[model samples]
Target: MSELSPYEIAFLSGGPTRVAQTALLALYESDRIRVSRGTHRVEVLPREPEDLHPVQAAVIDQVPGTGRLLGAVLEAVAAAPEVRAVADALVSGGLLRAGLRGALRPTGEGKALRRGFETSPGEGDVLRLAALGPEGVQDAKMREILSTDDPKPVKMPKKPKGGHRDLDSSGLSDTQYSAGL
Candidate 1:
């Protein structure tokens, strides 16, 4: 198998959110997106015609909410509240492409990563992994497994048999007989 790129690795571990988060982090690291030391917002700049992956280019175009810190932006976009907007922005920006039957398809390295986090197991796993990265997922799984305590089934006691000596042309005994019953 071919070695996974950082984007691919990020995708396999989680999903589109992780992929976008990884892209943003990469862009920031490369100085394509700059964050001030004391500021929460990041600055997105237009590219200057250089060799770049489509995802990077997409993110460069879709500069998102400018209120939170650099790290907070990634986390929030990767998680609740802003995640939906971020995802829509990613799709529009071309960082994300819809797949067969509207599944999350890889644009570049995302295809090569070869992940089914959205399908295999279930969508819940994909969302879970997305919400809690790889380490967090493992920790949660371990906690779940460890939290469960199995116990042997207890056998129910059988009732005493043969209270009636005989039946009066009926299969039922005296205990079963009643007025018009």
Candidate 2:
């Protein structure tokens, strides 16, 4: 990061309304760039600047999912009502350019937005399943393990052996048994 002046820092930190003033401060801070603030303003700084505009870089970095809504970008950066003011300042300063669907893109900004979804507790299950792949073999195994019960057989009470003696005796006679032999 380049060395920031107190005025520049104050201007940048003074909410989104002071974005134009912040840009001017940033331009003044840059050794390779000069700016003039007035009607028919003309000022020549140096060329081939080594550093880029910080505010524009930050705005670009906040943009996500390609061609994002202006309001959404503002909310993402927590800039709220000041977003339009800051955006207008950046546009006028030529530090930012509007892209498709009114999305802001930084000029000469490198690797603006960090691409990825935030990891939250709510997404744990989704991330786990995604990591496991679409086959769901791990899920099946987990379900099987969870559904298993104790491996024990049920026991029944024993009945008296003589309980059916009368019925058995009625079905046969002593003469029939002797003839069978």
Candidate 3:
């Protein structure tokens, strides 16, 4: 296989969300976007570079003119079609397994690619690696952004298995129940 691009490496490493984050970080590193340290607000700059990766452009599109919270922007861009296209390409290229909904398993080639990249990362791999997690990031602010910007969905606590005792059909548990009135 030909040498894979950093974006592709990111997809292999952590799927579409990583691709979105790589694009976002690339935009920030390139000065295409501005991030507010105080509020974690992300805004696209007026100056548009003629050449931008599809995911990068999509990330910019995800942001509003008034800017948006960093976490929300990351979530929006991760779900964008452009990011999905990267996954599709990987699947078609025999990297990622097809038909997996929740957790995408990588094919042999994908695993080897990830392993190779991890073992001997090139200079270009820095941003993509950083996008995977905060460990690879050097800048304190960027690391903070990487570590805190993406918010995971909260898992709601499960309801009690037997249902509420207060609403039991026997009526003994009911508030108005009078045992021997």
- Candidate number of the best lDDT: 3
**Model 2 compared with the native: what TM-score?**
0.22
In model 3, which regions exceed 4 Å deviation?
99-103, 124-132, 149-181
Q: For residues 1-181, what per-residue lDDT tens digits would candidate 1 score against the true structure?
A: 2433444445545565575555665565566776443333567755577876555555555556453344444544445433444446545544467889986554664443334433332333323334344333343532242123323334444445945433344444565456555
Candidate 3: TM-score?
0.74
Q: Between the candidate structures 2 and 3, which one is better when assessed by lDDT?
A: 3
Task: Show pairs that collide, candidate 1.
Answer: 40-68, 40-69
> Candidate 2 lDDT, tens digit per residue, 5-63?
22222223333423323332234345322322221121335356354545533434544
Candidate 1 achieves a global lDDT of: 0.49
How would you order the candidates by lDDT, starting with the best? Answer: 3, 1, 2
Error of 3 at 67 (Å): 0.4
In Å, residue 71's CA in model 2 sits off its true spot by 22
How many clashing pairs does model 3 include? 0
Among all windows of ten consecutive residues in candidate 1, which has the lowest summed lDDT?
141-150
Q: Give one digit per residue, the lDDT tens place, for model 3 in 1-181.
A: 4666667788887777677778877888888899877678899998946788888889888898999888888788888888788777878788988655656678988888788766766564345353344556666787677677544534444447955443344334434556546
The residue pairs that clash in candidate 2, if any, are none
C-alpha-based local distance difference test score of model 3: 0.74
Among the numbered candidates, top TM-score falls to 3
